[model samples]
Target: MSDNPAADAVLNLVKQQHDVLEKMLNNVSQAGEAQRKAAMGSLERFLSAHEAAEEAYLEQATKNLENMQGWVEKLTELDYTSSDFVTRFGEFQKELINHTQTEIQHTIPKALRDMTQAQIDLVQSAFERVSETAEPVE
Candidate 1:
């Protein structure tokens, strides 16, 4: 946690989001075919919102997560029950883990150190707003 209270708050929020995304990813991995689609959908929607908020408020402070848009598109194309989908999804999971770990270990703290309290507060507000009001991806 940063010495700045606002930065600390933003860090906490981002960490919580990371935990939620990890849980969602696990749900997708463990889900049966009948349930995989819903789990994946939830993950994708939340990811979209999270990325949008980061782009709007945090991109300048941290290296944005590697774009996983292509992975999402590919996943959408493959039948969830197929072995190909399983392989690809596993790959996506690995990348997600790496990206989140990088943020937690490096990018987030570095960003917070550089930001003023007002900027940190803006990031926190945007994250909360986007999380609450983000529309579901079609």
Candidate 2:
């Protein structure tokens, strides 16, 4: 199956946001106390915006994935066989894996514990709606 343009757009946006966040984090680390605090304010806003956009786009892509069946099949269709593509993809994969591991180990659990049931329910509802729209694999 051909790649979905909408999904590609979302993925590109997410990558861009990730780059911005990484840069902001570097700035925070290098800054003085006052500068660090200012950088953190920007980081907070970027993080919140990134999270919301990711959730929305991922919700749609999740449904599309169900229709396409397993992700491996879709991934295989991409033209990542070129050396340049492979190198870049490998770097992205490493960064993504590290980021995901950190979130799973620390960020997600803390957020789950801190959030109210109502807040959790809202997130659950959003995800459920996406799942509901997904076409089951035959």
Candidate 3:
């Protein structure tokens, strides 16, 4: 479930980080200053990692797909919850679900489906090769 073949390994890594990210963001909303600070560190790391991955993704994806990047930027900017861990995790989960739906139902498939077999092969080979060096997101 964590390893995504359609995306470059970087984005797959980010997607795999989702559960941890959700928990951290939720913690920040519920905990005191000390706990919040710890959660912030986790959030910062997730943000840094996801941002770096997204920037790399721009190179692999078609220009049209950069809009997906913009959406992710907005998503990462959102406060997962305002009052409590439950609410925050809920929000984060909802956003992740929505974004995942879009990626699977439209974005990634659209990019590949429009390609010729040779082009698909090229992209698939590149993904497999890159995946060899990257950690499994799941």
Best by lDDT: 1
**Tens digits of per-residue lDDT for model 3, 18-119:** 445555556655667456555655565554554344344333334434554554455445553434544544565565556555554456555554555565
Model 1: residue 130 alpha-carbon error in angstroms: 3.9
Superposed by TM-score, candidate 3 places the C-alpha of residue 74 at a distance from the truth, in angstroms, of 12
* Reference-based lDDT, residue 81, model 1: 84
lDDT of candidate model 1 versus the reference: 0.79
lDDT (Cα, tens digit) per residue for candidate 2, span 1-138 = 114333333333344445565666566445554564555456545544444533553343233323222322333344434444344434534554466445434444444455555654554454344334322211
lDDT per residue for candidate 1 within 47-89, as digits (tens), equals 8888877777666423555457677888999999888888999
Q: TM-score for each prediction?
A: 0.87, 0.42, 0.43
Candidate 1: which stretches are off by over 4 Å? 60-63, 133-138
By TM-score: ranked, best first: 1, 3, 2
| Among all candidates shown, the one with the greatest TM-score | 1
Q: What's the alpha carbon RMSD for model 3?
A: 7.1
Off by over 4 Å in 2: 56-97, 100-138
